[model samples]
Target: HSLHCQHPNTNFCILTRPNTHTHTHSMVDCHILLYIFPGQGAINPALQFAKHLIRMGVKVTIVTTVFAHRRITAPIPEVLTIVAFSDGYDEGFKLGDHDAQHFASELRSHGSRAIAELITASINEEGQGHPITHLVYTMGQTWAAEVARGLHIPSTPLWIQPATVFHIYYYYFNGYGDMIRKHTTTDPSCPIEIPGLPLLLTSRDLPSLLVPSNSNSYSFALPAFKEQLEYLLDTETNPPKVLVNTFDAIEPVALRAIEKFNLIPIGPLVPPPSLDRKDYAEWLNSKPESSVVYVSFGSFVVLSKQQMEEIARGLLESRLPFMWVIRETEEIGDKLEELEQGGIVVPWCSQVDVLSHPSLGCFVSHCGWNSSLESLVSGVPMVGFPQFTDQTTNAKLIEDVWKTGVRVTPNEEGIVNGDEIKRCIEMVMGGEEFTRNAKKWKALASKAVKEGGSLDMNLKAFVDEL
Candidate 1:
């Protein structure tokens, strides 16, 4: 006799008939294959999203580069399976903070063909069983769309950055190259009005590549970015839907601007479970509420030796109890040595757990999308010291639009001094006006992510459409 049983959550397990068994109804279901970008700060949110979907009784599989899986130490939530493809990139070659970007570029060049082959191989492995029902990909790995097309499945693009960044690129693709170039170069002080966007943003808020000057770092990165943007715009096959990792409460204006382009906002998608560290939790819980400051610069940006020294001095000068996640590139000079006597400097930490801790009063950050969302959801205000790329834009949103943070001015060499750092930190940590504004944003952020909230409903609608 054969036995067929279904779990409370609708997960099925089948047992074959012992002998002379009668025919029974077949039991199989659709699966979701997530193709992820290998960028720093990309995997954590993607993993969280996958976990939530799996809990809803959907099967989920993540496909990514080998290097990314190894480098990012955030423990993968249970119930999610990860499939990694080899890019022939060696992890032994220590490039410090350049690892994520290097792996992404190499994956684009060599991993695309491998990813295509892997998808076909995975499908064949499942033969006559559960076929893939949906293909979700990150913007970094645009090549996944090709594989999704070959499989004839619906593909969706997930943007880990802000919606404004995508809109800026879309504008660049629609024959505004000369205007964008002119505005970027001739007028750093001038505010460039985006055609489809509701809010007017200054040139300083746009990605460095959109600016016209050849002297900035974006000048070199622009060529590759332009090629990627062009690939996303060309609609030769199945045009995938776009999704951003932001809530409407934070950027309702930007959200409205991208509505005509068919973008979906389903975010503050941070993991619900705590990071797997009991000792750390105990340590954090020992402190009082709003007593500690959390510091981290999202993976890629590195500060010069002088800049690092100045920041270290400032932290010590402020005399606040802080936890700083120093990237491998942040070398300790004399100033850091002095501060280490008073504070903690870890190479990496359980970010979500750290932010959610009652001890965490404020965040000093580079304003990366993932970090910003985490801080907002955790009710921590910010002291923005943006280094590059969309970080500048994110800083503007925090300090200007949201009124929850203060921006520090960098010196001629683009290094923020000790006094500026101290001043910003004090303002974010204890200043009455800044604290009140931070609480207001915190309440709005909480409302946006709760049950029946905008992001929750939008996510449900997005899944239904699929």
Candidate 2:
């Protein structure tokens, strides 16, 4: 008997048969579907991984919001297929904190169901020659699991941040939210050690969301945050195998903590930039090694006006020629204008190209996991100024565990002044010990991604399991 399923929105159909009589057949073609999250940083890594898998002969498809699909300018690989969500794409939607949270919740509620139905229809339309063999999804969108379960396919959850953030979320799940809140706001200076985690961290080392305060508009985000945490802890029906976007050498402690869970570490997955390396080389050819400080905060971490001024002043005070990637939102008029008068402020430079530049020196960053790993791979020391999310944890790994960077302490108003910023940047760039350690990490990271490396073996194991 054959069963047919049709999509309401598109001319797509799927036909299937319930097996009764068995017959020998050759190996069936497999389709691997990746569900990408909305964030740009998240989308980049998903695209990188999809491209890599496709090059290795795995058929890959991406299901993301229509809005995101439009923002990306990079050429899509021919072997990879894109399936946009049903929500109409409009780039102009002004989403507030509450609206963003509501949208996330709605996606969790119905987004996966819509994508799954579409996949069924598309497969049927293609004459049922290939079936989806596996589904890999980003965290926070629990709906992907529904589709994977419905089709009896293995589902993997990709954690785009360091596993240390997961440890914090686990603590929150076990009724430690108040503890985290107290540490981040009331007594940020005190060191708090989490059980099974490697390093002792202070309140300021946790994500800003866990920091106690009622002033911000993120109060609406609390529920969604809690919902995501609950979903992470839920291991029964949605037993997702985990894949983290981090190298083993960068966060060994966090990696050790999640060892018992079915997890794979395959990362520093940054693709080389499209621009010619010689162009970047020509720009940096005159500079001295360990002399230039490269600055960039990840996409979403916005800096206040005061913070921007402080950072600008600090960079000027350091008296170092720097390459800073300033987002339009983070530019506080005269602060960046003034900095541009002194340093190079490119709106969006190719980050990997910048990092790999021969004359590039120190990285002054928010310590996002991606940036951190990139710095390591490039053999550059860092000056960590963590802003939010997993950045706090990543900062600790850089400053405390790796000993390749220094953390700038914010003042009473939660701001790091220009002088302190200058001091940290100068120290990381000028200190021989820091440079030596950074180069060591760079060597290790390079070896980790090579054939027979730890991450390479882990990737092989992951594909083998699938």
Candidate 3:
């Protein structure tokens, strides 16, 4: 089916296929339909693959929540098609406060029906008339896999985080769940061993989903994560194929850790620049090459007033020109006037564009996988101040395993103070070792995404198999 872009940002894209009399069994899978389900984070990597699939002459469609669709900061590609659906929370899912179980349940119910309708609508002669051949589901949208199973469609789960995190989740659900809970309950920072992983992970290094119930409270995401992993390990008849957003050279051990599944690495799925060439052109031009600090905590993750103050002070204390993306909700108080002395504080900006800018010297990040990979590919050193979820684990790898950055340690009050933030920023910006390591990874990442590279081959293999 060919897509007709009738209007800009419209939820439905008009698709053209053959007439009713011309439709037949041969038309079922001839269209090479690829339906993608994407969860929220920085930007949807699904869109990156959508462009690739479009170039490959595949019919691609993105089925995501209306909220996510609205939140997209850049212009949608004209070649690719997007279809938005209801997920009960059209206003957007509140991460820290929303009921995880209820969110999962609602997402499963609304999203499953929406997907079914979307697939059916495209296949029918009276509708789009293109039969879906394969479905690709991204992280946190495990219910997408379940829906595909019920429909007897071939589906692949895209692991957005590092392959090591996937290995950890598999172990958690398989047999180590109880032990991990027990150990972490006693000491949130106690070290433990997981099969296949070489490093000793303390609770501070584990994904926040694995943290047990206590004064820190319980995690609502565990159930959904468990279901996702169980579906991968148990429900599939043959070995399930998993697509990871990582390069084989970077995570060879973690990628090979699971023997039961085919984990394909086909990323740094970072998209090309979509912003106006002159949007931040002037700001970047004003700064010296490799002299500005770029700070962002991704889409979610709201810091407290105290934390915000500390970060603001830290940026000021460093006496470095910086660009910090602080969500509008947090008021900076009197520091707003002072912040103008050293930097700019906007609600958001084109992160990729900022990272790619010649002026970007260091990144003060929350270590979300997308941001981490962006920094790595852009050769920007980091000062990691992880908040929750897989961020802590990513920070651990950044500071310890990969040695691309320094992780900030909070004080006894569990707040990373301004002084500590300043110290980490200075260390990352001043040290040559971290900068050198970052540039090396950047080259390797660039190589992996090039023609016939490891990630390139992996992506081709996955697409060809379909």
Tell me, by lDDT, which candidate is best: 3
Q: Model 3, 27: alpha-carbon shift in Å? A: 13
Using all chains and alpha carbons, the TM-scores for the candidates as numbered come to 0.83, 0.85, 0.89
Worst 10 residues of 1 by lDDT: 7-16
In model 3, which runs have C-alpha deviations exceeding 4 angstroms?
Answer: 1-39, 96-98, 126-128, 213-218
lDDT of 3 by residue, 352-442 (tens): 8899888999999999998898888888999998888789889988998778889999998889999999999999999999989998999
Candidate 3, position 387, lDDT: 82
- Could you list the CA RMSD of all candidates, in the order they appear? 7.0, 6.1, 4.6
Per-residue lDDT of model 2, residues 1-466, tens digit only:
1224454665223333332322243123556778887776678778777765655456676777766666556666654567666343235223352375556565554566656765675467686446677878876565676667776666677878877787676676576777777777777788887878877877767765676752444454456545555554564454445788877877676766744355567886767656655443564677876567888887667788888888888988888888787776565666666676667876676777788877778888888777887888888889998877667778888888888899899898888999899888878877888889988998888887776877667766777566
- For residues 1-466, write the lDDT of model 1, one tens digit per residue: 1343322322122222222222232112546778776666678777767755654456666767666666646555444556555565635223443454565566766556655554565578675545677778776555677667766766777778887777777777667777767777777677777776766677767776665542454343456555545565565344436778888777776666644355678787776546477545665677688888778887766777887777887888899877787877578666556666656777877777888887888899988888888877777889988766778778888888778788888877667999999898998888777667767776877887787877768766776666
Off by over 4 Å in 2: 1-28, 86-89, 92-98, 122-128, 175-178, 181-186, 214-240, 258-260, 273-281, 335-338
* CA RMSD (A), model 1: 7.0
Candidate 1 structure lDDT? 0.69
Backbone clashes (count) for model 2 = 0
Clashing pairs in 1: 184-212, 185-212
TM-score winner: 3
